[model samples]
Target: MLLIDVVRVSEAVTRTSARLGKVGHLAELLARVAPAEAEIAISYLSGELPQRQVGVGWRTLQDLPQPKLVATATLTDVDALLTRIKAVSGPGSQAARKALVAELFSAVTSQEQSFLMRLLSGELRQGALDGVMIEAIAKASGAPSADVRRALTLRGWLPAVGAAALSGGVEALHAFKLEVGRAVAPMLAGSAPNVAAALEKAGVPAALEWKLDGVRVQAHRSGSEVHIFTRTLDDITPQVPELVEALLALPSTDLVLDGEVIALRPDGRPHTFQVTVSRATSKTDVPRLRAETPLSVFFFDALRVDGTDLLDLPYSERQEILTRTAPPELLTPRLTTDDVNKAEAFFTDVIKSGHEGVVVKSLTSPYAAGRRGAGWIKVKPRHTLDLVVLAVEWGHGRREGKLSNLHLGARDPESGDFVMLGKTFKGLTDELLAWQTERFLELADGPTDGWTVTVRPEQVVEVAFDGVQRSPRYPGGMALRFARVLRYRPDKRPEDADTIETVRALML
Candidate 1:
């Protein structure tokens, strides 16, 4: 296929908000692609390449000697260039794609060319698809996104995994764990509307912990080789050699453990999220990191211990096994207080000692892998609610051309009205602002002008608020103390969003 041909698909993918349009675009492009080009296209489109992918992701980005020079290079020329680069440099080099993109951009007219650049750079985000990347892929493939999702969920790769069946066959993708693992973001909770009551009904004690303002880490081990990964599953092994050494020293352990790796002071007080980020930095700075912002981990759950599936075990049982099996430096502490008063004492103690509130846990609940269930309840006097974005306002300074702040709202349980809870300028990123402005517009219905747009409550957002305050902003004189966009909810709906009544109840 011509480079321009690929550009057209990317153009279509960007402009059309409908899932089917994006799907049709990719399908059309794939039908005409040569074997190698198909491989490149499919691989890149998956967003996550193989664990250690076949080529430098930037290969196409950096290969061009004069990528920004803007000179036309034939698709045949681009193909030949990529083939030559691939043959000479193998998978680690990024030059090929750079040159191909440069050539493609040059070949197309100016307008299409700009879209192509954004497409290649991953700045081409359109919030129109129902939800997530796979849904859009499903629309493109003429199948349910759910079906495509299942195939990838079950098989671990997508479009590319499916596309590869044409040549190397599905067996080739057998070991594929599609989404690149090890980049630790965070594992969020999916809770019942009434978390406390839900746990009571489920025949489990609801233990609540102050949801930490820290990063999550997943440690994977193969014999003595221990690798630490982020929630996103990106390996930070090279950065935390001490952690790896600590895991390797563990006795009777061939495991992958789940925990929060946090930075703390010499006096044992936990630091803020900003400090915890140092644990994810490079090994070259380890000496300085240790000296400046020392750290420790709190192991809450174990996934694979000595090759046993620990996910089925009860929470208390997992903690017991973790304590017995883990090394001192490798483990996160488990707070045990069955009595509410004792738990309260511990919670107060930790908070006063500069720690966040304590997490109360259910002894009998099984490890809900990649889930937040009634087994855990975080009891803090501090007010917090996971809200959904109702609207966004224009930004200024460095944040210009993007959303300045979000019109944060919580669900009204009685009428499903997304009553405006507050507006937040906190946690605004240039990229996020751009992403949300375009996204917030998608949810708009009537004119909610004068710096706000009324949205059809569809997206759920997690907002960590300082406290709820009385405000004349909306019916409830309650507004958020501190508010920010945590993450975009794919599994949750506005109906499932936290409500003002729930927020007020927490005031108790």
Candidate 2:
């Protein structure tokens, strides 16, 4: 298929705010895609690439050659070029990759160039989310949405799902099942503000487990071969040896277990998220790296065991299977309770132990993979502080031309100066962005550059964050993690904002 077809569909999809319009545009595009071209077209529409990251980023795309007179770039042509780009590595590969990108860029028209740029840079703001794409594929192929979703979740690849649906319809989707060594999309949980709310949502006879501050990992094992996948289904088997070794030693040979991989302190409390992340992403000398960080997997749910799929089983039955198959040490710390006070105690204990909180799960609910259903609910104690905005950066893509990313600061009580915690562009509505853009200009300390504008610290905004981490880059020794603007605190003064000492206390 021609690249123009994909580009036109993406443009139409982005131009519409209606979900059905987006689905219609994609369904129309899918009908025309040949089996050979289905994978690439679906991948592009779904805002992903066949080759993943091909050593090309925003900086390299600048000052490229002008567009060709004709749009001749085919799906196969672009795919082949991406394969070559991914192959370029080590010494002198940067220039080679850039040259390949330029050659490919020069082959397409300016309109196609814009589409390719957005797709490559992950700025594909077109509402072609995975759920929408699955529905579109189902609509085009005459398969049920449930069948397509199940296949996509188990297969964990949209391109393959697209190809299967196009070729064999619902039969192909039914053929896709829980396979050992293949990653499945994980079941996710909804959020509640507190334990009482979570228990109320979960109802009675629920299992409450400590929500460890760690990476969500799904382990697949068949004898000596074991694979560990992140929540997004990225295979990190080679990076975490301890996790692999533990899986290999498990009594059950063929199974899929859902859990968290956490690095723990000597006191058995989880290490800070930053520490765990650095160890998880370490690529070189990983065995030595594993010893340095020493990760552990705490299994909470069993998806499949001994060739029997457990996803359809009730949570109570799945927990029993997990306890039976996985070692006791590998099991997550958990208790079955419906008592609000007992659940509250568990929540308090989790926070006091430096962990995140607790996940209250319905005992009778099945594992609804890839969907954030009410079966499981998370309760985490969120700490909100009134912090002053130090500056704001111009947003990009969807948020372009707006004062978005906020530089948050905590007041240092002794010095009476603000200490930068971190920057967050999350949790801001378009209305908030417009309001802040005009309001901040009035409080600007200097002239605006359209890139970043510094503002006086008189405005106090309430910020909610997960926690703080030790940072080497900031003036303060610590920085906020996962911070988001909850709301503006116009009634509060800069002096009334939380102190750096208060922020530091969270680190402990």
Candidate 3:
């Protein structure tokens, strides 16, 4: 199909307020695509490249050659260009890449150019992403949405599952199964305010396990070869040789283990989350860095073993299998109990061990991949503080022209000034967003950046965050981790806001 056709679908999806309307638009486009062009169309419409990274940036795109004002750029043509772009690297490859980018950009119409730019920059403002796209694929193929989601989850790639569903319908989706070496998107949990609430939501006989503050890893071992994947399914086998060796030495020849890899002190307590992230994201000198900052993995669940797929098994069955195969020292500390007292005690134990929190799971729940259902719940203690809102940035897409993203700052008691920890654009309802826009606009300074409206640091907003991290970007040398606005504090003054010292204390 023509690239313009897909662009029109994208535009229609972006323009609609209704989710079903967006899905319908995408479904219509998916139905007409050819089998071979299926992946490219889905990837493009989803604002991603099949080749993943194209190595082009905004600076390189700024001075691209003028468009030809033609709609002749096919999806296949774009894919080929991306392939060439990915191929260019090292030395004079920069100039070669620029030339290729300009050459490709010059071939498409101006509208197509705009679409390409948004897709390439990862700034496709459309609300439609993988979730919506999966629904659309299912709708187009006349398959159950649940089946499509399961297939996509098992395969960890939407385009391929989408193509199969298109070509072979529900049977193709049903044919998809858990493969030993393949990575699947792990099941995620919904959050509850406290342990009792989580247990209530997840029901009785809940399997509560330590929720470690670390990078989630899905390890696959078949014979001597082992592959380690992140929660997002990026293969990181080359980055952590020690992890590979550990998996390779496991008694089970074929296995898939779901767990968290945490950096720990020699005494066994976990290092800070920042240290864990640094160790996991390290790309240079795997063997050398592995010794400097070693990661200890604690397996919480098992999905496959010895060519047997265990995803369909209940949580208890999977846990039993994991305990049987996983090394005792590497197993995540867990408790299976219906008593709220026991669950609460386990939660307290996890906190005392320097972990994040506890995950309460249903005993009878199957591994529902890529879905955040009521089967699992994460219970975390909220740490809240009154912080001053320094500024509010304009929202995007549906939220356009509204004050949404908040610039939160903590009071520096020593200097009597607010220091920016970070910004949060989450946990706001439409009503709250509109109210903030109106209220913050009244307190706006005379001059504004058009995108950001600066205001006096008098409005105190109650913010709840997971924790604080050492950051070089902020003047306070710290930033709030996963910060969200709970509500505006009308009674509190900026002087009563939490201090930088308080934020730093949380880090400790």
TM-scores of all predicted structures: 0.59, 0.75, 0.76
lDDT for each of the candidates? 0.56, 0.85, 0.84
Error of 2 at 111 (Å): 1.6
Q: TM-score ranking from best to worst?
A: 3, 2, 1
Q: Per-residue lDDT for 1-508 in model 2, tens only?
A: 9999999998898787677878899999898899998999999988889887887888889998999878888999999998898899999999999999999999999998998887887656566777678888999999999889888878889889988998889998899989998888788776666888878888897889989878889999988789998876778888888898898888889999999998998888888775786687678998788767899889999999988999889999999989889878999999898788888888898889998889999999998887767899877788666799999998889888888999999876443458898899988989889999898887777778768889877788877888788998799988888998877854345655767876786783
Worst 10 residues of 3 by lDDT: 489-498
**Considering every candidate listed, which one attains the maximal lDDT?**
2
lDDT of 2 at 374: 88
Top TM-score model: 3
Cα lDDT tens digits, model 3, 1-508, are: 8888999988988787677888899999999999999988988887778998889988888887778766888888888988999999899998999999998899898998999998887756465767688789999999998899999889888888999999999999999988877999888876677889888888998899999878889999989888898876778888777678778778999989999888999988899766786788789887778889998888898999888989889999999998889788889888989999988989998898888789999998999887667899887667766799998899999999899999999876433457999999888989889999899987786465588888877798877888888999988888888998777755345655767776786773
lDDT, model 1, position 211: 44
Per-structure clash totals for the candidates: 36, 0, 0
